[model samples]
Target: MRWFFYFAYICTMETKTSKIFGLRSVIEAINSGETISKVFLQKDLTGAISNELNGLIAQHNISRSYVPIEKLNKLSKNNNHQGVVAEISPIEFADLDAIISTSVEKDKAPLFLLLDGVSDVRNFGAIIRTAECAGVDAIVISKHGSAPVNADAIKTSAGAAFKIPICKVDHIKDALFQFQAAEIQTVAATEKTDNLIYTIDLKIPTAIIMGSEERGVNPSVLKMVNAKAKLPLLGEIESLNVSVACGAFLYEATRQRL
Candidate 1:
């Protein structure tokens, strides 16, 4: 039997289901600058506290979903959720611009990892650990549809999640354009091309883009990159785990640099 490896992340640092229950409590967490991955609100829930929570969500540009009370119940373990629950991120996200600017000032050609839509916490954690070990400068992820950075991911990363600067963006294209603007090249990891990563020059300032576990890079995103390459597969097995592929890509860059 052939086993394909497809492994992977989300936009924020939700080190797990570390959550805050109660409407007023969630509001407080937001005001306190706690990194919140998301807030689940009871559908049609209306009150002074609800208004405050909505305002906070808007002010902070947080992602909120009006879920059924049952969903909240499951998330809160029947705790006094008060119609609201907020998933708290253990680590704060860094600004992509700041990381780019700082990297430009550095001596090493700055290597970055951009996840298109990787969705597994275990994969995400492994990727983070490998990225840090391979000297990756930062990792970027989209704000929606990606997996949450739960405790499993944190444990898998061996706390590398705390060590790395992760950036959350509204769209993958935003980060892609930013890198291009800075004259940094983007190389998408995909099997859609005849190009092999071995031929690509990893010594330059580069951002390597890995796609979702289900699909490779999005067709739209692939059109926007400087290049697309893939690792070789000699056997019948078609793919590598997302984390394993990420590690391979990262280490390849490391190998070339060394």
Candidate 2:
């Protein structure tokens, strides 16, 4: 009788454990476009649930990991996690046109940061922190080449991601055209320019374009810029990292405004 009870208890525990392990809850979160920090899946678990989870992660650009079942178990604190867990956040995005209109209506100079092909989430977050500190009105990024505004990005921004306006656009060129029409001077930070950043008057309505570390600004964006300026390189390095360059440019603008 005692032996039978022990066997039944073991079966019940195992059943409860399996019920809680894996994809159902995680898939629901992804489908909602929730800010998923990370997703973990049991290694070698190939099933309907895993397939659906993988498809959703890929479609939404959510980061994921295939880990041992024990890892998932540990994460869930022995809850029936079924073999998957996802960390998420409550981050929000700002509307692009609304930000632009609000900045202009306030009679502010509308100091803006335009990021071209900057894929690194850390860099994106750091730039946002600096831009907020320097009183930039908004930070614009292209939809295709930019990093997703995930939990890591929000944390890296020191909460500035929530405080500052971020504009995600379909085509950077179209956004540039709108800025130009609004009488906002668009300046590209490029090594190709002979003019230095300090020489340009940022006190006026300005949009500063900072490009990617690998490719610099897209050629079309470079051509559309009202002016192209470079930070004078006194050091041996050819150029500053994108985030550092963004800070320098922003502070220079701040100084001019002051």
Q: In model 2, state the lDDT of residue 227.
A: 97
Q: Across residues 162-222, which tens digit of lDDT does each residue of candidate 2 receive?
A: 7887876766787798789888999999998799998999999999999998989888889
lDDT of 1 by residue, 1-258 (tens): 111211223323332458889977888888888888878889999988799889999888887789999999999999999999887777888999999999999989999999998888888989999999999999999877666665667767877898999999989999999999999999999999999899999999999999999998999999999999999999999999999998889989999999
Per-candidate RMSD, Å: 6.3, 11.9
Best prediction by TM-score = 1
Lowest-lDDT window of 10 residues in candidate 1?
Answer: 1-10
The positional error of residue 194 in candidate 1, measured at the CA in angstroms, is: 1.0
lDDT (Cα atoms) of all candidates against the true structure = 0.88, 0.80
